[model samples]
Target: MTVFLIRRLMQAVVVLFVMSLIVFIGVYAIGNPIDILISPEADQIERERAIEALGLHLPMWEQYLVFLQRAVTGDLGRSFAFSTPALELIVERMPATLELAIAAMGISILVGIPLGMWAGFRPESLAGRAIMAGSILGFSLPTFWVGLMLIMVFAVHLGWLPSTGRGETVEFLGLQVSIFTLDGWSHLLLPAFNLALFKMALVIRLTRAGMRENLLMDYVKFARAKGLSTGRVIFVHVMKNIMIPVVTILGLELGSVIAFAVVTETIFAWPGMGKLIIDSINQLDRPVIVAYLLITVSMFIIINLVVDILYSVLDPRVRLKEMKS
Candidate 1:
């Protein structure tokens, strides 16, 4: 297990390095920030100074090397638009994004697993059919549209929830969290539900598929032969086995939710990293854009590594295979 973990960590490092290079080069290629930073009426000397200050005057390779070195030392550079450290700005908004992601994942797991189990257990029932139909809509609808419809229904027409914003927050463990407060939770519900819709559908399908496959396996039949209660056999024996795949998907989806919540955040006006990234992109803030990409890529790598390690814990056969390899 230790050797396997080490191997995965090394692979993660390489992936992160390649991702950083791609992000750096791609962000630079988007456009010169100096064009936006410097005024239209600025003279040639001012333009030259601005370009030099941003290290744009240096050769691309040289600039990349400098960036790599600074990044290694945790210096991601200052945002041209915000006049602040890119990393600091991202960190400031990390809590909000994390809150939303966690809430969304919680909703997905809590709701999806049971619905999936029910559908798998009674696929032909009316309720199961209804759940499957809803899952289809969940997968087919666009996120933005879902978010808008949620707002129109819950916020505009019913007035049961706020349409936007991360409502009042109270500090907990040195971080401000909204869920602790009633008003804040009311604000969080709609967006988190909107963000979780697709993931919930995906989890339901995967879980249902896994449950169906496992229910017919010899071990499950043996457990039933042993006179174990149906509930215990299904919930304890089958659910545990089915969770391996579900957990893997949840881990990857969690990373994606954090990194790609831009549309949901924008539509809901949530003050999170996704909204910040959108603003940075609009302003062509190279440092912030590159930093966001690197952070997100690193998150994906880390989550994937964690999921791989979790596989060993959840299934001994996985660890045995890794050792044999």
Candidate 2:
């Protein structure tokens, strides 16, 4: 197990290095530095001085080396557009994005697994058919459109929640809380639900399929013949064995849920990395863009690593194989 973990960690490091190199080169290739270098009012000498100051005359390789060194030291440089440290700007916005992702995943897990179990139990039942049909419908809709519909229904038409911003001003536990923090939960209802809808549906379908397959195994029949209750035969005897693969799918899906939340965040005007990245791109804020990409890529690598390690823990067979090797 330890050896497997170490091997994964080393691969993760290499992948991150490659990702950084790609993003760095891509940003550099987008345009001439002089476009941002020379202001409209600057004279020729002044423009040349600015170029020299920024090392625009250096070879592309040399320029990339300098940028990479600074990045390694946690100095993403100041944002030209914001006049602020790029790292600082990203950190400030990290919480909102993380919060949204976590909330979405929590909701998906809570609702998805149960629905999946039900559908798997009686594949031909009315409830199962309805759940399967809903899952198909959900899988077909775009996230942005779902988010819009949620806003219209819950915020604009019904007035059950705020349309935008985290929440209304409120005091909690003697501390003043921002709407996004306090009433923010209320506001999350629509966005989080919208974000989770498709994920939950997919999970339900996968779980149902896996459960059905597990039920037909000889061990399940043996458990039933041994006088085990139907529930026990299905859940304890069948579900446990099939959960290994389902867990892997759930982990990978969770990582994707975070990655794809960018679109939902934008539609709702949520203050998260997604909106920040969009703004930075439009302004050509190189530092902020690089920092955001690094953080996001790092998250994916870390999540996948965690999922790999979990496989061994959840299934002793994996750990036993590792030990023998």
Candidate 3:
């Protein structure tokens, strides 16, 4: 297991290096650095001075090496547009994004799993049919459209939740709750649910399909013949086997949820990495862009590594094969 983990970690490092290089090259190819440095009416000497100041005369490889070295040392440079250290900016904004992602994933797993289990067990029942229909609709709709509709219905029409912003000035349990603080959890519900709707449907469908397949396996029949309780045979015996695929999908989807939240964050005015990325792009803030991309890639690599480790623990067959090899 240690050997496997080391191998994966080395692979992740190589992949990240390549990602940084690609992003740097792609951005550089579009324009010269001097263009950003010089004003429209700048004289020739001024242009030369600006060029010298920013090291535009240096080779691209040298610049890339410098960038890579700084990145490895956790010294992502200041944003070109915002004039703020990229790493520090990201650190400041990360909590809001992390909180939103956690809320969304929690809702997806909680609602999707039960709905899927029920649908799989009673395929022809009205509840099952409704779940299938809703899942399809949820899966098919565009995320932005769904977010807007939710904002319209829940915020505008019903007025049950705030339209945007973290929360209002209020007291909870005799404690003053600030919108920018932990008390903001109340304002997070709509955005979290909106972001999770598609993921929930996908998980439900995957779980239902896996459960149905497990239910038809010969071992399930044997369990029934041996007089195992229906719930035990289904939930205990079948569910474990069915979870292999579900677990894999869930891990992959976890990263995707973060990516998709970019749009949802913009729509709902939720402060997150997604919104940060968008703002950075609009301002041509290279450092922040690179930092955000690196963070995103690292997230996927970390999640996938965890998934691989969990697979070995969940299934002895995988562990045995790895050991033998």
Which ten-residue region of model 2 has the weakest summed lDDT?
Answer: 171-180
Query: Candidate 2 residues 165-271, lDDT tens each?
Result: 55653555543334345477887777788888888888888888888888888988888889999988876877777678777887887777766678888888877
Q: Quantify all predictions' global Cα lDDT against the true fold.
A: 0.91, 0.78, 0.80
lDDT tens per residue, model 3, 1-325: 6787777878899999899999888767756645654578999898888666555667889988888888888887777666688987876666667667778888988999899989999999999999999999989998889988988998899987776766643554443333344437658888888888988998899989988888899999999999999999988998888778888888888888886589888998877778988887765667788888888889999998778778777776787237432
lDDT (0-100) at residue 60 of candidate 3? 85
Please identify model 1 stretches exceeding 4 Å from their true place. Answer: 320-325
Candidate with best lDDT: 1
Q: How close is candidate 1 to the true structure, as a TM-score?
A: 0.96
| Candidate 2, residue 130: lDDT | 92
Residue 170 in model 1: lDDT? 99
Show where candidate 2 strays beyond 4 Å: 33-42, 49-57, 168-182, 320-325
Worst ten in a row by lDDT for model 1: 316-325
Candidate 2 TM-score over all chains jointly: 0.88
